[model samples]
Target: MIKVLIVDDIPETRNHLTKLLSVDSEIDVAGTAGSGEEAIRVAMELRPDVIVMDINMPGMDGVAAAEIVSQRLPTSPIIMMSVHGEAEQLRRAIAAGAREFLVKPFSADEFSTTIKRVYERELGRREQLQAITPAPSGPQEPGSAEEDHQVVAVFSPKGGAGRTTIAANLALALMSETGGRVCLVDANLQFGDVGVLLNLNPKNRSILDAIEGGEPDADLLESVVVDHSTGIRVLLAPPSPEGADLVTPTYLRKIIDLLRVTHDWVVVDLPPALTDHTLGIMDAADQIVVLSALEITTIKNVRLFLEVADQLEYDRSKLRLVINRSDTAQGIRISDVEASIRRPVDGTVVSDGRLAVLAVNRGVPFVVSHPEAALSRDITRLARTLAGEPSTSASTEKPKKGLFARR
Candidate 1:
């Protein structure tokens, strides 16, 4: 429930506001203060989630009190209320660190929503601050006996290039191939869908939880990672977009390092753009699986990404270009695409829109659910190549119904 403290000099106004908030089942009135001075005292004592302070108080006005309260407890959001809807008053409230302002005679729904918004906003700010703060040093945990663990990052320069799908399926394939020692990280902090794709709840247990306690240990990481039915361990993204800012680049590095020590393979699903956090992950990855589709726009973005990678001094050998939906009859052949991008396609996932959509809707990896499908075979081959394992003898033979066979 949202804990709220009502502050108003008028006794009747305080009771009315408290009654209004009480109607909402999600909100609880922690306490009430008669004046701004009393409000600061009560806030310091209770540290309510939200403060509804009335402006134009007798002694200390709302603006002055809000500034002091904000300084004292930066995480608690303040909602300033006034009878006059003057621009100057709004400016003063904002300058004093009030998260929201309400003119008197507002409806209960509006009041409740404003409080909730401010509270959520404050929580996000707190999480971001915690993320940037250096974690406390802890005793180093023992590393895994296996020393050949690889960190593979799946990246796309544009959205809807099927990067997450590939990352999820690849991780599942690795888990099967490696005997259940794979970890998949949803690194697209702001709007990651790895959990949804895999059908994991991702609530409370996320990458944010792993790093929120400061220094990450193997135990912490293990506790936060959720197990997928496909036998892959997953570190999910934050439950809300507001919490994305909480996972800082420094925290991510520490988490990945810890994960590498615990899991045989760590597969990260990256966001479309190149942010500082994404760049850090790419720098640490043993292989960068760059994904592209048959669309001209996506291919162009991929080419640009390759150029940027070169400028960043990334080893060309570490980059693997995969064309998703390689069998699309868009009048563009794989050879033509290779020539256009000036690079050989390392892998191709055949397009089967119906099967792909069904797999996603069922929250099952395409390879696991439809092992006989052409898309599954392609992903399996790609996984094998990434794991540095040579393909089997059967893999050498051409498929009788190859999806990418030339017409």
Candidate 2:
């Protein structure tokens, strides 16, 4: 039987996961822990084949524990769990050697499938390792670092344009292509929803750590990431709402630059309102995904945003306009939408309320939940297009870069 350890600060979550795994005939729950400290002790003693860890824990967080466990037990695979949308945490988790990640409130089927996949992948790696006889056992130096990493920022001047949603799904889509490292940051600092969108617990060491310059070590990043089903990693917002202001624009750039060195793609979800931090992100971004819906207010905001970008002297080529929830039923034509924005719409993502609602409610990315769905397909195409491939797609229009007055 496959042995597993469940780690979460909350008893209910641990109990629920335990009960769910209990029904599996081939799996055994070797142990469980409520804190990061206890988890380390239990994990070392149990030495289970797999660990299901929650990123948010009191005193010692899950990422910290995973770092220790991965080093001590490189043979074992860790599957991280969380509800926040901070990108730093997700990148940190993968760096710590986690094999897979499961979002919170995951269905029984998702949970089981992930567990199975993790085991299979780990087992597969071991098989491959065994085939190579008598290889030198010293530390493997420079296991292929991610290079030419591009910074993509999803920003909107107006609220409710689905910038966060686009950034989240697009990051997952990028993962599908390269299987390289991807990081999504909820730079909406003050009112970020990347965490809520993924349903990760509020306690992530993302924006707070980046702002404070705490845990600057490369290994510390893994200790804070929440893993999603699609293998996309996330760094969630602060555990508390009040902690947002602590992050400044310089810190945001520093954090993004730090990630660029390690990650193949760094996607940031910026605040609807332009702050100093937003401008910093815009200046650093290799590509700017501007999201807007087909509404009068959204169009007007896009125009104003464009004006701001012009004022800031941001490159127009880097700005890619995306129209979210584009529907003819809304009495808006693509022609009129383009006429309003003056720039050609790079891509459009059709509205699928059913799919989107289900994805957000489950704290999962729609791209993973319904990869074959219309939205998911479009997202994949968009991902390719962002990577410099072409795709004839349809959605809303938003300005690229900050085209608004500097605050």
Candidate 3:
């Protein structure tokens, strides 16, 4: 039940407010105060979930009482009542930390709705605060150097190729094998699935929180990146799709650069298109793990994206081609994929539909939950190769013009 405290100078007004709230079974009128001073006393003692207060009161007004309550009891949201819905009164109430403003003579519906909305928002704010894991503030490690950090970008020319799942698990595998700080970035922007795959939510706190104030810094990054129980930090994409427009390519690159300095490995999951935002991450990444499926259309797009990467002059060693669901070739073998794309497959993950689906549904990385499983072993081996084993493959092919004019 939502416990509420009603504060008003007039005895009749307080009684009427209590009566109005009494009709709702979900809300319980825990206390009633005739003045703002009494409201504070009752609020501290009762510690109600919501406080309905009059903005105008004798001796101490609602604004002053709310500011104190907000500081002392942040979880108890205050809803200010006013005689008029003027802008000035609303602004003052907000400045004093009132979560909502209600004009006088409001119906039971509006009053209850406002209280519920404010309470939900306050709960979300608390969750966001508890999720973020601040960065380490001390000096760098004894023998650490600038070249020690690695920024790996997981990309796929086609969607639904398990790019997000691979990225999330790879990050966990890296953390397990290397025992270093790993930060996973959901650069997919619009419709990112990283948070869902990891059982995390933005809760109005995402990369937008890091970039809104000004140029992002290590301190800002510390505030927005959330910590997982497995010891990996995640930078989620914006909560909504339209919020993607506010994140420019420059800001994305800046955030990537900042993360590389603080983390041993920064894994960024990219979208399927060839947009500027994707290119910015590609340019900043030290290695790009391109994911492909065992299907005809997926192989075709992979070929085209490789052509684009060649035109952009990405070094062959920088690109690692990995085929997902390789066990279900269905007359299309791995050799066909290699010959079709004219590139060797660096790694391949077997198709285990049951385990993969179960892992995703349970929001646990297979590498952590079932380390000895085939899928988990595959990802762990790949992680070790990327972390410790350097690739010897180099491209002898020449860059062809007009593959992508923009490049």
| Candidate 2 global CA lDDT score | 0.75
* Pairs of residues clashing in candidate 3: none
Instruction: Name the top lDDT candidate.
Output: 3
- CA lDDT of each prediction against the hidden true structure: 0.80, 0.75, 0.82
TM-score of every model versus the real structure: 0.60, 0.67, 0.64
lDDT of 2 by residue, 30-79 (tens): 99999988888998899988899998888888888887777556667999
Instruction: Count clashing residue pairs per candidate.
Output: 0, 34, 0
Tens digit per residue, CA lDDT, model 1, 1-407: 99999999999998888888888999999999988889989999999999999988999989888877765566688999999999999998886768889999999899999998988887876564344222322111245454466788999999888989899989877765545378899998989899778766634688878876777667877888886644567899998898888787867877877787777778999999877777777777778999988888888898988988786656777889999999884887888778888989999998888988998797777877777789988998898788774212111122222112311
Worst 10 residues of 1 by lDDT: 390-399
> Residue 16 in model 2: shift from native, Å?
22
Better of 1 and 3 by lDDT: 3
Please give the TM-score that candidate 3 achieves against the real structure: 0.64
> On a 0 to 1 TM-score scale, where does candidate 1 land against the true structure?
0.60
- Off-target runs (Cα >4 Å) in candidate 1 are 1-146, 389-407
CA displacement after TM-score superposition, residue 100 of candidate 1 (Å): 48
